[model samples]
Target: MDRKEQKSIIEGLLFVSGDEGIYPEQIAKVLEIEGNEVINILEEMQKECEGAHRGLQIVQYAKVYRFATKKEHASYYQKLIDIPTAASLSQAALETLAIVAYRQPITRTEMEEIRGVKTDKALQTLVSHLLIKEMGRAEGPGRPILYGTTKEFLDTFGLKTLDDLPALSEENEQMNEADLFFGSLQEISK
Candidate 1:
């Protein structure tokens, strides 16, 4: 591929890699290009993002390349986070929260398994909104974080306690766990 196409592909790779970032060698392998060429392209992309108009910058941590917000925009980003809104939970975030509400001390991997999609962004949203907090670490490999609902979640939903949550219908054995959780959430909201 051409230089411009390579840059675009690399940018996409970095975006999809998220917090895990991407190694230059991995990018080289994927694009079928030389490692040195990948580095040169990454450096060029990094420089391009350094422009004043760009809100994101390419950062390399421990040889892993990823896109991160510019440090100079921290105040603006903080303001955005601090600002309150009447926005309701997104479907993904709401579903993730419901799963956590019923399944306390759940790990992100477990949530993803239930939802059949990646839960990282939704988990981050719930954590940022203070609806869920890391309860502890699960016992096993990686010691994955266990998430549970916070007090704010209870107050927001106007529940006295976890027991206040509606019980799933035993008659609907065909209903998946996520659907059952969503049903309970709807009943709670009403």
Candidate 2:
């Protein structure tokens, strides 16, 4: 409705978007406003976040907007990180990890196609757990990030190396990749 309302809505969108973040064009499309106006509002909001010394701040990276904790709170956050916690992986995260493990350099879009749903939260969890990482960027448009399993994956799975992974039967290999991914997830969850 008004500039304040627009800025507040944009903040909420960025907060909910998490690490994936949102683009100005996406905000403009949703708000039915000009892209230039969205850009100007976002810039002003960014300044307000910085000047206010609020615990939360807006970050723009790769043209994506996200809400993040201020850098000044890093020490406190690090203290919390140092605490021990046993976090269990969600089924979706396990499935995404399995796909990344077998596919070895898959993109998020490809993973989503296999999962038949958006995999952003699962992907972020895998990344946070250090089971999957950005191996590189793809060759095509936007150069989407390519994900791959890491050494932590090997250690967590108690495998000596990727070669230690069980081989799929010829018939199974021919089955849908999503099935293979789910099969792997079941095996690991055991």
Candidate 3:
């Protein structure tokens, strides 16, 4: 395929890969092209995306490329997130989000322990919504996936930083941590 055609194919692959991203070698292998050629096309594609003033742009991280909204259009995207007519969080998803937001870098097992229910569905919902994502793997035998809120979470909730999260009440000795978690969720859900 010609360079232009190759660029188009690579762009489509990146879009399909989404947040997971795609490596140049992966593209080259799939397309039956030289790795260096794929890299060159990606470089050219990146320049065109920025120069064309497109709403979306290609970005590379850790030698992997993904398509993402341009930073300049954050406010426009934030407007859409603020008015999420398409998707609303179920009660379970909200509770899962609350736990992850407050006690981030936490494992699924830890959340399940606190909630006293399996969080598989709720965690999947949060991840699919881009509200929460894998922060990293936890230490120990199982090496469970740790979860944390995303930048989209901050933008959607109007938080300047994690510190902007509503403070948990320390004065009420009777108030449990779950109460605090739900309290934060209510604020963000608004």
TM-score against truth, every candidate? 0.51, 0.49, 0.53
lDDT, model 2, position 76? 95
- Answer with 1 or 3, whichever has the higher TM-score: 3
Q: How many pairs in model 1 have backbone atoms within 3 A of each other, for residues 3 or more apart or on separate chains, i.e. clashes?
A: 0
lDDT of each residue in 23-137, candidate 1, tens digit only? 9999999999999999999999999999999999999999999999999999999999999987668889988988899778899999998889999999888899999999999
Candidate 2 lDDT tens digits, 105-137: 999999998878999999999999998999999
Question: Candidate 1: global Cα-lDDT?
Answer: 0.90
lDDT of each: 0.90, 0.86, 0.86
lDDT of 1 at 127: 92
Give me the displacement of residue 162 in model 3, in angstroms. Answer: 0.4
Q: Determine which window of 10 residues in candidate 3 has minimal summed lDDT.
A: 172-181
TM-score, candidate 1, is 0.51
Please report how far candidate 1 places residue 40 from its true position, in Å.
68
Candidate 2: deviation at residue 50, Å?
A: 46
Which one is best on lDDT? Answer: 1
